[model samples]
Target: MLLSGELGPGDRLPTERELSTRFWMSRNCVREAVRTLSSMGVLESRVGAGTYVTDLQPQVLLDGSSFVLELLRHRNVWEVMETRRVLDALAASKAAGRITAEQLSELRELMATMDSALDLDERIAADLAFHRLIADAGGNQVLAAVLRTVAGGTTAARKRRGLTDAHAMERMHAEHLLIYRALERGDADLAATAAAAHVAGVEAWLLDTDDSPADQ
Candidate 1:
C-alpha cells in the first residue's frame, strides 16, 4: 500500500490494534511487520507518537547500502567501471534527448568550473557535479542514487590509492566538453560514446598504476 501511493511519506500508520483487526492478524504479527519495516528504513516510530512512513528519498533509502558499495569497490574496481560504463552511457544517451535548457546550462557551468579549478579537490567537485547533473537529466532517481553510491564509494579511495595530477584534471575537462557538446546537439549515440570514452580513460588510469582498489 505504501509503495503503491496509497500511503505516502509522513503519513501515519494505523495503530497496531487497528492494523491487526483490519488485516485479521494477531497483534504479534503486526508488531513483527512494523519492526521489519523500521529496520528497512521504510517506517519510523516516534517516542510517543504513532509510526509514520519515512521520507522515501533515494538518499535515505540508499544510505544503508553504502557499505555494500564500499565492499564492491574494495573487492574489484573493474566491476565498478564495468557497471559505470553501462549506467553512464545510458544516462548520457537519455540526457541527450531529455535534458532541459537549464540542465545544459548547469553542465556548461560545471565544465567551466572544472577548467578553471586550480586544485585537484575543486576539479573533482566540479567533475562530480557534472556527472550528477547528467544523471538527473536522465530522469531516473533510482539509477542516479546507485550511481552516486558507487561514485562516492570509490572516488576518495581511488584518489588516495592512484596517482593524479593537474594534467589529469585538464584531460577530464576536455573530455567533459565533448560530452556536453554531444548532449547539446541532442545526439544520443554521440553522448553515449563520449561518456564511455570518459569513463574508460579513468579506468585506464586506475588500472595503470601498481595500487589497486583493495590496497586502499
Candidate 2:
C-alpha cells in the first residue's frame, strides 16, 4: 500500500484481525508483519491507538544503518570507504555554497579541538565532528544521516591507520585545513576535490594494508 500510494504518512493501518481476514493470513502472521514494519520505521504503534504509517523520513529509515554497516564492514571495507568518499565530497561541495556563519564558527571550534586534543581518542572524536558538521551544513539531512553511518562504520579501521603512522594525524590535519579553506572561500569544486583527496588518502592506505587485522 505504501509503494502503491494507497497508504501514506499518518495513515492508520487496518487492525490485525481485519488485515488477516483480508489477506487470508493467520492473525499471528499479520501481527508479526506489523511488528517487523514497526521495527523498520515504516509503521508506528501508539499507546492508545493502532498502527499507522510513519513519516518515512530517510534519517528515520536509515537509523539502524550504522549497526548494519559495522557488522558488514569487515567483508566490504573497500566498498564502504568508496561510498563514504563520494558522499563526503558531495557534502563538502554543497556545504561550500550553503554554510552559515554559525556553522563556519562551529567548524573553526572543532578544528581547534583537534589541534589541542590530548590523545588519539580525543583527536579522532574531533575529526569525526568536523566532517559531521560539514555534512549538516550541506542542508541535506539524508546525506548527513548516510555519512553518519558510513563514516562511523569505518572509524575503527581509520583509527588503526592513524595509530600505525606517527605523522598521520599531522598530515590529516593539514588536509583538513585545505578542505576548510575551500569551504571558507565558498569554492564548491575545490571543496569537493579536497574532500575526496582527504578520504582517498585513507582509502589507499586501507587497501594496501587490508590483509592486516588492524586494517580490516
Candidate 3:
C-alpha cells in the first residue's frame, strides 16, 4: 500500500480489527504487523487518535539498522566490515570531488586531534569524526544514513581490536593520511583506493585477532 500510494504520510491506518478481517488474519497478527512497521519508522501512533503512516524520512527509517547489525555481528562481522569498506570508499570518492573548503579544514583539524589524542577513546572519537565528515561531504543523505548505521554496527568489533595494537594504530594513521591527501588533491580514484585500503587493513587485523564477538 505504501509503495503503491495507497498509504502516505499522515494517512491514518485502518483499525486493527478492520485490517484483520480484510486480510483474513487474526487481530494478533495484524497487531504484530503494525508493531513491526512502527519499529521501522513507517508508522506512528498517537495516544488519543490512531496509527498513521509516517513521513518516511530516510534517517527515521534507518534508525534501527545499526541495532540490527549489532545483533547479528556475532555471525556476520566480516560481512558487515565488507559493507563498510565499500561504502567508505564510495563516500571518499564522491567527497574528493564535492568536499568544500570548510569540510577540508575540518578534516585537517580532526587529523590533528587524532594525532594528539591522549587516550584510546579520544583517538577513536576523532577517527569516527573524520569518516563521518567524509560521508557528509559526499552529498547523498540516504547513502550517508546507511553508512552511518553500518559504521555504528561495527563499533564494537573495532573497539575490541582495531585500535588496540600499537603497530596497527601506526599503520592506520598512515592510511588515514593517505586518504586525507587524496581528498585534498581532489583525486577521486586515489581517495577511493586509499579509503578501501584503510578499511581492508582493519579487516585484516580483526581477522588475525581471535576477535571473540561473543564478548562484544
Candidate 4:
C-alpha cells in the first residue's frame, strides 16, 4: 500500500486465491493469515462483498492484544510484565516526539479517572487505559499491540495477587503523572527514564511480595 499506492482504508482485498498465488503459500496459510488479521481488526469481511482493509485506527487493531494476553498462564505473568516495562519505556521515548495534544488530553482524563476510582478493579481498568493511550501515541502499531498484550497480562496478575493497596495505587499514579509531564515537555529521554522508573517500582513491589510472610 505504501509502496504501490494500491492499498488504503476500506480497500477491497484480493481474493484468497490471488493472495495464495502471489505469496506462493498454501491456501490454508492465506486463510489463517486472513483470519488472524480479521481478529486484529486489520481486515473486515463482508459476506456478500469481500474482505477489505479496515480503517487502520490504532484502537481497532490494538484491541486484539487483549485476546492474545487472555491465553497466558499464571507463571508467564512476570515475564509479560518485564516485556511490558521494556516496551513502555520505548513507547514513552517515541511518544515524546509524536504524541498529539488530543492524545495528551485523553491521557490526563484517564489519570483523573484513576484518581477517582473507588475499587481495585476500577483502578486497574483506568491504569490499563492510561498506558494504552501512551502506547497509541507512540506512533508504532506493532509496539502498541505488544504493550497492550503485556499490560493485560500484568493487570490479570495484579488482580489475582490482591495487591491493590492504597500505597501502591498512589505510587503508580504519581509515576504516571511524572511520565505524562515528561512527554508534555517533549523530552523523550526524560519520558523514557520516568517510564523505566515506574515499571521498576512495580517490579520491585512484586518481588517484595514474593518474599513476604504471606507467600511463605
Question: What is the C-alpha local distance difference test score of candidate 4?
Answer: 0.79
Each candidate's clash count: 0, 0, 0, 0
Error of 1 at 182 (Å): 0.2
Model 4 spans > 4 angstroms off: 1-9, 13-43, 53-68, 160-166, 211-216
- Name model 3 segments beyond 4 Å from true: 10-30, 210-216
Candidate 3 lDDT (Cα, 0 to 1): 0.86
Question: Which ten contiguous residues of candidate 3 have the minimum total lDDT?
Answer: 207-216
Query: What root-mean-square deviation over C-alphas does model 1 reach?
Result: 2.7
- Sort order, lDDT high to low: 2, 3, 1, 4
Highest lDDT: which candidate? 2
Candidate 2 deviation (Cα RMSD): 2.3
User: If both were scored by TM-score, which would come out higher, candidate 2 or candidate 3?
Assistant: 2
**Weakest ten-residue segment in model 1 by summed lDDT:** 157-166
Residue-wise lDDT of candidate 4 within 1-216, one digit each (tens)? 423768788799898899899989999999999898887788899999999999887657667667666555354555666787889899999999989999999899889887887787987788888888888898788788777767776765556444644487678778999999999999999999999898887677777664442221
Report every candidate's CA lDDT.
0.83, 0.88, 0.86, 0.79
In candidate 2, the residue pairs with backbone N, CA or C atoms under 3 Å apart (3 or more residues apart, or in different chains) clash, namely none
TM-scores, in order shown? 0.84, 0.88, 0.81, 0.72
* After superposition, candidate 2 runs with Cα above 4 Å error: 207-215
